[model samples]
Target: MRYPIETLGEALAEGIVTGHPAMPQFELTPPEINDLLSYLKSLE
Candidate 1:
């Protein structure tokens, strides 16, 4: 989409595979991101 699939995957994997480094923290695994992304795509 906006940043290319690989780019999006990387961003998702970061806070996911590792963990958010800053405040207001949250995390998502690869599978969770994929599911969220899939839901988002369905809205279009």
Candidate 2:
């Protein structure tokens, strides 16, 4: 990961919105975000 997991989590919590054609904006609950972060961390 290029950034710290916390930073990634924060971004996810805030909802990722971009002007790009392919990317979609989305947000998750704190627990859902934490679960996702844990899964990503497990890959390492």
Candidate 3:
């Protein structure tokens, strides 16, 4: 099953705050996060 789009965005937001294994920690505005999530959802 696929994960919810909002969940993905939340995870991404958290990862950016906590830092992911291969990703550097960075801050993103809410709109930016929404844009990213939109793009990711397109791929799904």
Candidate 4:
């Protein structure tokens, strides 16, 4: 969460797929990303 919401949104929009074995590959819809960003920003 060190990154700004805009940067996080941009990254989320493209989807996230890590090579790490424990990480899950998935993409979030615009609304979902917005929800997540809201929750994250609440912590700030």
Deviation in Å, model 2, residue 39 alpha carbon: 0.3
Give the alpha carbon lDDT tens digit for every residue of 1-44 in model 1.
25555366567767533344565656788788898777767776
Question: What would the TM-scores of all predictions be?
Answer: 0.53, 0.72, 0.53, 0.74
Steric clash pairs (candidate 1): none
Alpha-carbon error at 3 in model 2, in Å?
3.4
Off by over 4 Å in 3: 1-4, 14-23
- Model 2 regions lying over 4 Å from their true place: none
Selected candidate, larger lDDT, 2 vs 4 = 4
User: What's the CA error at residue 36 for candidate 1, in Å?
Assistant: 0.4
Using TM-score as the measure, the top candidate is 4
Ranking by TM-score: 4, 2, 3, 1
lDDT of 3: 0.71
TM-score, predicted candidate 2 vs. hidden true structure: 0.72
Cα lDDT for residue 33, candidate 3: 88
Better of 1 and 2 by lDDT: 2
- The residue-by-residue lDDT of candidate 2 on 1-44, one tens digit each, is 26588698888877666768797667799999999999999998
For each candidate, C-alpha RMSD in Å? Answer: 5.0, 2.1, 3.9, 2.1
Task: Put down candidate 3 lDDT per residue, 1-44, tens digits, no spaces.
Answer: 35578686776666534434675667677799899888987897
- Per-residue lDDT value at 44 in model 1: 68
Residue pairs clashing, model 2: none
What's the C-alpha lDDT at position 25 in model 2? 69
Alpha-carbon error at 7 in model 1, in Å?
Answer: 3.6
Better candidate number, 1 or 4, judged by lDDT: 4
